[model samples]
Target: MAGILAWFWNERFWLPHNVTWADLQSTEEAAFPQAEDLYLAFPLAFCIFMIRLLFERFIAKPCALGLKVQANGPQKAQPNAILEKVFTAITKQPDEKRLEGLSKQLDWDVRSIQRWFRQRRNQEKPSTLTKFCESMWRFTFYLYIFTYGVRFLKKAPWLWNTRQCWNGYPYQDFGIMFTHHIVTVTLITFSYVTNLTRVGTLTLCLHDAADVVLEAAKMANYCKCQKLSDLLFLTFAIVFIVSRLGIYPLWILNTTLFELYEALGNFPALWVFNILLVILQILHCFWSYLIIKAAYKAIAKGKAGKWNPLHVAKDDRSDIESSSDEEETVPRSKAPHSSISTNGTGGANGTNGYLTGGTCSEEH
Candidate 1:
């Protein structure tokens, strides 16, 4: 197999200046990155948290305070009841139809209706604590998601490779794995959208959650402290590798590919599932390849500073895209509050409540 692959590669690559095979092998070994002890990430994350505390206290806050950026403060902005009702209605659904309804109800012009609603929407925006909590929760979630990815799946056979998970037939179904994936995906979408308002309510919770916390932390960077991005990418990358790249393939991919076959055989439905799962693995490898390129570029350029945290996107578009079928267009209820801000004076992250995060994350 190795000989076949090498011959195939040699033919395909058609080496520059007709470089010899031994020379290529030596170059490959020399260029390979040394593995770092991932355990060191725990303390490194702590150090990052401390750096955030100081930066917020000394830098972000002071700058905001100096610029006098607090608008309307924590105290609620009072509008008359009639106008308040009109205003609240618009913020909930900012549309011409809703504005017209308020105009007809309040006997106001459409222009007047629009103006009051706009002012009120801006004014009623949640407290900084609301935004802080939102970002903080998201930051925590990303970390948790990464950690969770590593935990249950690590012990399973497939972590090492795809072929292992299917070695035996009719494997026992672990109740926890089934519950976790469905529940966690639901929670992340809900959390991302809801935090746009203020933390609302929660009936149940997931055991562990980063994509969450790093989000909150970056939202804080909206104060023009964009350096937070590098710190977050660094902190989150370690756990992301163990969980996303580490266990997910072995656990989810293997089961979907090999193990499921034992129970379902080669049914059309099973084949459909298998094909999609294989496609997903192909995408994962492609994304990982892109991430590797980004890492090499980060090092080649001076932007990486002294640290190089190889990133893994956990930006599973398939999972997210699938959720769209389950989630509603507009949530019937206001989401759990962790206030989201799109204001330039407020922060540099998010489109409404969904932070675009950064160029790196968005690419995935």
Candidate 2:
């Protein structure tokens, strides 16, 4: 077991040939990333989580209220022990057959059962105000981080010249390095561990830049500012596509995959790093697709042109009624389609953004 651990952690596999762990160690003049330094991430994360709670309570919630964001969703489901059990243990959504079974079991009409299920689902989902607060907190954080990244990168030579990224072949003055989601966390961990801080910092800044717009769009959505939300979502789509697909592939991928090979030649660790970067790019493409789809839907909906605050109440009532109608004959193609960006970064990016089943919600 010890032998396997030693072999797996061999410096030759992680670092470029002729480089050793000692060469990357921190000195009085320079500080390099140390494995043990990751311990700080745990406490820092806890502190940040606590700060988020406070921000949501004292800052974001009040801001949402001031903006008159709705504090509640549809009415709650009435008590139904059997339905609750099925919802918890079986599925939140029941098929026609299951609904029939439930209707018969509860001695209720199918429509009531469907309404109960819908309300129950809404009950489990976050209120619009809660979503607003969450998005507000994220928007604030992402905006701050992007600004800080710009300030930090202004002093970085690589920010101006891509070739400067490979100047010293990974052993340079410790400068650059730096998310919360699983994908973000994984990227950060791998980049820092490999001492690819410069590239990592660039990625972080790009993502944060996109996230600021994305969160703002979400907040606008929850606030029922349809025009602003559509506009912001469109803006996010452009930014995400430009940054993640165009700039990322041309700048980051080219530099890491092709330029690095030209500069330093191939190495096992470099391949590993490049592979991870390629995977991230693939995810970027996936997210761009979703963002574009959502943006296109926004344009089709004409939300930017037809919005009226006074009409919202009536529209919302219609929306709820249509959603609750089980026998409605609306075509599946015309049904409102929502695209979620999983990573939570891009205008609508996050793990929550662009996977097969991303969690990021682009509710239109």
lDDT by residue for model 1 (1-364), tens: 9999677545223222223334323242242111122244456677757766775666555544554443233223335597676555544324545644554565544433333433344444454433443445445544555566557556654445544433432222322332222222333333222110011011111113334534533443433343665565444444344445655566655555566555334434345444554665576567656655655665587565322221243432201111111222221222232112212111223222222222222222
TM-score, one value per model: 0.38, 0.79
Q: How many clashes (backbone N, Cα, C below 3 Å) per candidate?
A: 32, 17
Off by over 4 Å in 2: 93-105, 179-184, 300-364
lDDT of 2 by residue, 90-190 (tens): 65456657755765565655545555665665565566677678779988988988998899898999988877887885567775455332223665676
| Alpha-carbon deviation at 132 in model 2, angstroms | 0.2
lDDT (0 to 1) per candidate: 0.39, 0.66
lDDT for model 2 comes to 0.66
Regions of candidate 1 where Cα sits further than 4 Å from its true position:
1-78, 88-115, 173-219, 222-224, 230-264, 271-364
